[model samples]
Target chain A: MKSALSTLLQQTADLRQAIRHKSHTGVTSGLVQGAMQGNVVILPADWANEFLLFCQKNPVSCPLIGVSEVGRYDMPELGHDIDMRHDIPEYYVYRDGVKVESRSDIEDIWQDDMVAFVLGCSFSFENALSQAGLTPRNVEEAVNVSMFETNIETVPAGRFFGNTVVTMRPYTPKDAIRAIQITTRFPKAHGAPLHFGSPQDIGISDLSKPDYGDAVTINDKEVPVFWACGVTPQVAIRNAKPPICITHAPGKMLVTDILDTALAVL
Target chain B: MKSALSTLLQQTADLRQAIRHKSHTGVTSGLVQGAMQGNVVILPADWANEFLLFCQKNPVSCPLIGVSEVGRYDMPELGHDIDMRHDIPEYYVYRDGVKVESRSDIEDIWQDDMVAFVLGCSFSFENALSQAGLTPRNVEEAVNVSMFETNIETVPAGRFFGNTVVTMRPYTPKDAIRAIQITTRFPKAHGAPLHFGSPQDIGISDLSKPDYGDAVTINDKEVPVFWACGVTPQVAIRNAKPPICITHAPGKMLVTDILDTALAVL
Candidate 1:
């Protein structure tokens, strides 16, 4: 009889295998249960150092979990048998800052000097929130979390610079307080929230119209709690205009074997 | 040469001596810096058990740090040579649920059946917040923290039952997040805030007119963050209509030798 932990691990590995074979090429949100799913960023070696500095300076927005050596496709620290080129369910190919194409795999365009960076995503904490009975609205609604661009600027590093991007989830004050405590444990997954209450305070004028992803209902008694989104790095990369860059498509991520609870800090 | 820790200890002892001698009879807010200051409650032996159960059931509003034996005036666990009858700067004496008189000391009225309770107060965490550069508005203005009676009910114990009382501090969303994290470390000091943002959500009608203590300014960009107040037990005692009840006057706390940092959980 397999334990629950072993069952989760088997399911995670199976999902990754399915993604690798291009048999599962859809949004990875709420998939693989307790396993970590990360945002993918692939840049040429010439641009990798600057991007690393960006992540270091703006840790809440871009929490770098695993960085592949130049031209390497595996991230052994994040998971066993993880292949950067094909593990993600879907990939976005960007040319000179503008997204040019979406593909099931990036193996054909994978460069020798390409470096893959895996950033810790909010999915880890979202799973924790659900287990704690505070399910994120996006997960409950089966939609992408609402992502918005804010006036809050990121600390610039070389050519990588842009305003922050945040994901919003509506929760009542009581539930929001508990959510803050629960998420504060996962610093690798953006940790706590950057702001709550008035959306306009952070330059988000309209919660109904998000810059990316579908907007969920913000009830009369609920206030929107905003966390620094993994999409923030993608916005910075777009501004930097690296001649060629690769990223996971919105809501699509690289599933890893690491347990989400393993990211919690004291 | 005395170490910094020794100096603080000496200062705390000296301040307590001043308070005990009636040389200082003002609010203890922001006084004795890093030392723990507590909400004082004195009740007869017949009612002490009920109140103790109340504190146990409603730990946030009445966090029990030290409770003196029946008919005892000394609280050695809280501070060296501490006299509960005179250590607090001021005292409020309630007769059959109604506040009858306020005095600098309660030595004349001390009874053989009396027990003293010292509850954890927000001043401990407020000192920590100030040290972290998030000085509470009440401390900055040298005013008592605003406290309100909320609709949130405490878990009942015997005859002691009433709605919770909460203290308010205003901060912008960003600062409130940091405040929540900082205060969560001090569970004895009411832990994290009970509510933030909308005042009506917690049954607070007017920010300008607090039920107890002086109201502090709430800035334009700020939202009021509230913590379960130490005054809650007083309200419960009032409703219970005990033959006699004694407590520290609003903002007049019993200064203890316990270091505020010692209460931090993690």
Candidate 2:
């Protein structure tokens, strides 16, 4: 008999097929149960090396999983026929580090000098946390996870330098402990939180107002647990100001064929 | 040339010598830096089988490490010449399930039908917690750990049936999470905490007043974290009401020759 995870993959393969036909283009968070979802960043050949260095410098914020050679849209390591231009839900086009356009696909924008990099996402650890009986509040609410800009600085690489972006998950002290234990197992998916209690300590001013994504409910006892977000690279990319760049829209990740457990350090 | 752990052991050996001589019959909380100190429970042969079943039933609270043969009075597996009578600096004598006396030694009460059981203590996990930068508060305050009786009852074995006794360590939500991760690695040392957060949620009425030991200061930002303590077995022993029972009194544990690292499951 097929395992439940195998069943999740069978359904995910069908969903990916729909995505391939451009009939389904949305956030892929709950689509694949056990497969790894990734944040996508595309840059020109001249800027790719520096961005790769940026990811290497700040692994917790931007854990680089697959780096495609310049002008190569094919990602054989991540999946079969995984075209960079059309596999994702949405794309954010950046010119001189400023977001210029948002599109469902990037076929026409694909450039020969462009190189694609796949980064491990916080969502990779979400499954682990849930499995450990610390289901994140955002998952229960069925919303985009609350994210914020933190005072914690990311390591600089050439022109790339900015404060990190962090995803927030509110948990009671007990659940938060379980969450920490769960997340620590996945080092590639941002090993552990930068800070947990009193968001102000990490320079987050307001709990009600988030920098990105849909906000979820925080119970009276729940404290916001902040994890280094994959969106951190977009902030760094903005600081670098490459003439032309493309990335998966925040929260709309590139769902890959890789298993989430494969990314766990232990 | 010697490793720091080896040097630390040399110092611990010195402390153990003092402990053995009844010259240092105090809490062994911080005495031997990294040695595997244990909770000692000695019972008459007629009751030893029942206590062994209790340990087997409630492995977390009473993690059985070494169980000696009846009338053996020695534990080569734990250490050379670990006499149940003289090894533990302080011993608690229970008659009809009541703690009747506290003694520095139990040589006079030693019996030919007695068997000693060495159980893993939370101190083993505390060492791991401290090394991971989540030092338990009890160790830092230099006091006997604050312990509480919980509503959560342990599985019964023979005549033994009682609720668990847990030790509390206060930490901010973040550190609590890290502590959970650190402690999970030492299942032999009570593994992960049974509960945390609101004390009343687990039938703990007041944080200030404890059932046993000293209460340490808990900052407003910190939440009390509780783990299944070594003291749980004493409560079980009290409930079992064997005509006579003996255990290492409070924090004055049996300092074994075994290394703490040797007990680490991971």
- The candidate that achieves the highest lDDT relative to the unseen native structure: 1
What do the candidate models score in CA lDDT, each in turn? Answer: 0.92, 0.85
Error of 1 at A32 (Å): 1.4
Which stretches of model 2 miss by more than 4 angstroms?
A1-14, A130-135, A170-175, A204-209, A218-223, B1-17, B205-210, B217-222
Judging by TM-score against the true structure, name the best candidate. Answer: 1
Highest DockQ model number: 1
* Model 1 per-residue lDDT tens digits across residues B181-232: 9999999999999999889988889999999999898889999999999999
The lowest-lDDT stretch of 10 consecutive residues in candidate 2 chain A is A8-17
What are the root-mean-square deviations of the candidates from the true structure over C-alphas?
1.2, 3.1
Q: How far does residue B258 in candidate 2 sit from its true spot (Å)?
A: 0.4
All candidates: TM-score: 0.98, 0.89
lDDT for each residue of candidate 2 in A5-49, tens digit (9 for 90 to 100): 677667656666777678987777766867888899999989888
Off by over 4 Å in 1: none
- Give each candidate's fraction of reference contacts reproduced: 0.67, 0.50
